[model samples]
Target: MKPMKLMKEIASDIVSLVYPHICVGCGSVMPFGGGILCAECRADFDEPVLDRCPVCGRIIYHRGKCRSCNGTRLYFDRGHSVFEYKDNVRNAVLNCKYRNMKHIGRYFGEIMADYAEKNALCGFDMVTAVPLHKNRMRQRGYNQSDIPAAMVASRLNTPCVSALERVVDTKPQNFLSREERLKNIKRAFAVRDKEAIKGKSILLIDDIYTTGATVNECAKVLKKNGASRVEFLTFSCRAED
Candidate 1:
């Protein structure tokens, strides 16, 4: 490399050791500096504007139940998310899951906790996360959902329970169609401790909600094993066009 380039690299290494650049959204250099996202990009994050279904939390064109959940029997009682899955929020979520940016999970978890409190969504008896199959967990070295679940539980002053387990290692839900996703996740999860969850309301944590297949299947197992109720909170969801 050129002498100047080498000097720049050495300087960057020194700065990293001292200051340590960290921005969860967009990988931008934080100027005013001290949060997950840079100030400008943080302002660009969008919240959902459309009315949502009470049960599924998908955007509804009208004021009533969403068409997606109108005829379907959902296992979870309700669901909600902090941001629409797009732009800076999307980038943050992707980095959190794929790039080992676990701090983003804790940051988003705090935000979700605030949202849950404001919306009166803190009625659950316990908190838990959708479990990864052992093989997948081994590959990833972590179940990404667990960090946020624990953080949210801490904020809510509730116990974070590892109450569900993935019995079958399934295909990534984003790669499948709605029908394929539902079939792919069927019978995939089982309750780890039925006695602990019996008659208890569970708040399930996840990173994103797409077709709702994964969380719904998890809820199915939890409810079948005696959880009195199952509801979910996620970082983002499919945006309604």
Candidate 2:
């Protein structure tokens, strides 16, 4: 190797030794160029979701709606999640939300984008992220879904429209039971642009899916405002069974 090139490599190694990149999923030091998730975390996360319920997108064993959707009236036509909310995936999402690791959100966005492409989940006129209420946005400094939603839109070469707004500042859905979640999230969102939404297929992106109350409510608002079709994609889904 040339002397200058060797020196540059040495300097990079020294810099990395001083300030190593940490894996967002496991909080371990990442090898140079290993990216956000380390090898083990990647292996745990990238497995294809198998036997998922088509209606609510929860991983399931049999056909048709899973337990979460079997008895309920849903607003969104259908939805799918990239990973079930557990283990490393769960840790990463919590880190993104609580620890304010924006890069982790972006990493999930790229993962979602890749999943969309591989699964042929395109054809939406616009992509959107579930919005944060103004108060939450102020407290959190950013919507965790926004960067990933925009990245997915960029992958599809479509516009990422801010088409919905959260009108109510409800309690976090994680703390509530399914019944309570439904009550807490009811009518929480409103469409921002009926004209843009009318007759358009919308792809909504979020970080996690639990009882389906939140995204279902968003879908209800979209359809109510005349959106032709509403589908949601999330980084993880709760495996209730």
lDDT by candidate, in order shown:
0.79, 0.86
The reply for model 1, stretches above 4 Å from the true place, is 1-22, 46-48
Worst 10 residues of 2 by lDDT: 11-20
Model 1 lDDT tens row, 14-82: 643433245667776665447667776668664445677777787656777766576667889999877
The model with the greatest TM-score is: 2
Across 17-44, the per-residue lDDT of candidate 2 in tens digits comes to 4333777778888777777778998899
